[model samples]
Target: MSRNKQAKRPKLANEGFTGRLRFFVGRALLNIRQNAFVNIVTIGTITLAILIISLFMLVFVNLEGVANDWSKRVQVTAYFEQELAPEELATLKSRVLAIPGTDRVTYVSKEEAFKRFRERLKGQELLLEGITTDVLPSSVEISLKSASRNSDAVAVYVDRLKKVPGVTEVQHGEEWVRRYTTFMNFLRLAGLLLGSFLVLAVIFIVSNTIKLTIYSRKEELEILSLVGATRFFIKAPFLIEGILQGASGAGLALIILTGCYYAFLHNAGNFLSFNPAAAGLAFLPPVYSVGLFVSGVLLGFIGSATSLKRFVSV
Candidate 1:
């Protein structure tokens, strides 16, 4: 008897695994086949949602990148007074560069500034022919150590810059910078709100899809319940079905995203000449792709779990 029981243990374990596998696979296929229309709709909705999410994430990241670059390169143009001497302007440039957060101060001589102005007015050579170095002011162009969109930090620098000698004007459009940051902040917030709405929408669509599939098998579920089957035993298959649906949908979305990115790179290669890999405009990374896929799968399972809870409760 002892030998027989030990032998039966291995058989039982194998049977259990095989049964579970069959149960899950059977339900997954049944769900897919039975609710073809609704399932397709759900997948479509999920794909659209993920695509929007991918695009917004790309835009937001690049916007933040460009903002940082602009901030770091935010030039504080310090124009000198008309009567300011060249020696005094040179001394002022040296002092300004010595300050903390000051990366470099380029002194734009009056002659160099006039030449640039003439170059810019290439077509209207007659208009700029009489222009001399005296017409352009000597100035120090300031570059900061780090790019930042922080208003307080920018305000502090603005105050300090105004105090420098030979500084006729320290001009930077703080309001303009503030507005741009605010706009980006608004976009970030709007994306969050939209993402939440889309996620909730996908959950509902998936739940209804799973619910319809479960309803078609109401007889089987009822019979199991009648035969003393536990809720876990009855719901396990449906849960697995939902997971399959979610995973498939995520995989499809990833494929679409990859294709779109590749197409963009291929077609827009000329515009992307400045950056070989187009560092500024890039697709979502592998980590994010995996995360999104997992999220979709989990959402499917959770939606199924929630929808099944009511039936089990009864």
Candidate 2:
């Protein structure tokens, strides 16, 4: 080959990458600008769906947190019988402490319990006049390690506590805890069901929008095919279009979400001293946000390609 032609070859190849990228971006932009109304509609639909999903995800996450906090606060107070001797009471306390799943056990003497009652009824002198420490029952407060906090598991420990001397009542209910757990489970299930429906709707909306765009350009695609243009060359611009749509939709959604977070936080802060860390707002994780943008673009692109495939085969 001639030196001039050989030197031109490297430059041409280098230009190919830059040239193709620019061409793809230019074409995508042209199409978007030309079909501005359609693009806006497409973006709006996807944005609404994404917003609903993000809000639900935030609510469910915080609900789970609240439920967990309630569960952690759940404890048992074992009341002691008055006739029990000092040695028997000490032995009972030791045994209760040794029970499996028990984390920390606290003893509430009758005097302390009576003092609490007096303070509770501090303003009601008539009610407090006959009340005394001797009338108050001594009790032990039990906090279980997480694993042992379940109703069924705690029941076994409660049974063991009942068998100990001087133990009158072992208080922890299966029904109450079970109800709360069931409610939390329902929240999680509902979130999943709603989230799945929203995702499907987004995909369908995005895909249909792409299909319409493809149909509008059917004549151009056919001409490209007639000229012996390869499928990749024909499809590259559309794929880029999809990516741009995804990225833009995601970016827009994030901006809206950020505004919401700040507004809600601002309102909360005004009413009550709000700690930003504790609230854990409806903000998408960075990775998920990036994925959302990429996914949107891919969804648009793929839908376009799939719609075009039927026309291309001819």
Candidate 3:
């Protein structure tokens, strides 16, 4: 009899892990079904919070794309000394092209510059009536590579252009670039602060919901404890429940966001056609989409963990 009892001990211990896993899963489902109202409220709250945050992220990403597009359009106009010989012009072009980060260099003859000026003075042709091509200096328009179009990079290029022998003046719109950079920085900071608040709010709401669930199952938990069940066995079901709620809510939010994104794209097609950047707007990238889902799971797990710490002590 002693040997038989000893043999059963190892078997029971081996089965304990699988038994606990099954118990946690079954109880989690039972609790979700039994407290349908609370589960719905919790899931709805999470969905709303995540949806708002996702929308903000989409806008920020697209705004960043547009800013990059604008930066790429930035060009430096270097006016050259008039009446340069053909050989001097060729040498200047070669030297400018050799500069790092120079994407393209176009020589704008005096005649072309005067033509562009006349086009700008459309209705006010009198401004150019007495002006000749000689009055405007020939210039080399330098386009910087995308990576070199920032304020500091453009400033460096301006200094280099000034040192070039035949160049008289360089205009790269430094003030405008500064203002644009400042505005982008402000937007990013504001978005980060707002996103942090939204995540905290989600955690708070989830924690309270889990606490209520725990309170309602207080008697069951006490019974499990009295029957020699471990603390992990008692708390595992509630943790699983919290994870389910978060994942479900996130899935719903993704569905709704996708529908709205496509609807807006379809309806606003005409309006977006007017802007080049708007035409290329996109939903969240795949990496960010995966991140949003992972964030939801973590939020739920953390909320449940916090609630369990308080209730398990009892």
**Each candidate's clash count:** 1, 3, 0
- Candidate 1 lDDT, 79-185, residue by residue in tens: 87764577876677678876666777887878878888888988888987655679888777777766444565666776788888667688767786677667667
Q: What number of backbone clashes does candidate 3 have, counting pairs of residues 3 or more apart or in separate chains?
A: 0
Task: Sort by lDDT, best first.
Answer: 3, 2, 1
Which residue pairs clash within candidate 1? 72-147
Q: Please, what are the lDDT tens digits per residue for candidate 2 over residues 1-314?
A: 65554244344421577887887789889978987887787677667656666666666666766677777766878997774567876787689878888888888889888888878877886887766678878888888887765667777888888887677787776677677657766877887898888788877877787687678778888998899888877888777777677667766876787788778776776677776556664466677667666766676667777887876774
Which of 2 and 3 is ahead in lDDT?
A: 3
RMSD of 2: 5.8
Q: Where's the lowest-lDDT run of ten residues in candidate 3?
A: 5-14
Q: Which segments of model 2 are wrong by more than 4 Å?
A: 1-23, 79-111, 125-168, 264-298, 308-311
Q: What is the lDDT of candidate 1?
A: 0.72
Work out candidate 1's RMSD over C-alphas. Answer: 6.2
Top candidate, metric lDDT = 3
Superposed on all Cα atoms, model 3 deviates from the true structure by an RMSD in Å of 4.4
**What TM-score do all the candidates reach, one by one?**
0.66, 0.70, 0.77
Scored against the true structure, residue 153 in model 2 reaches a CA lDDT of 73
Better of 1 and 2 by lDDT: 2
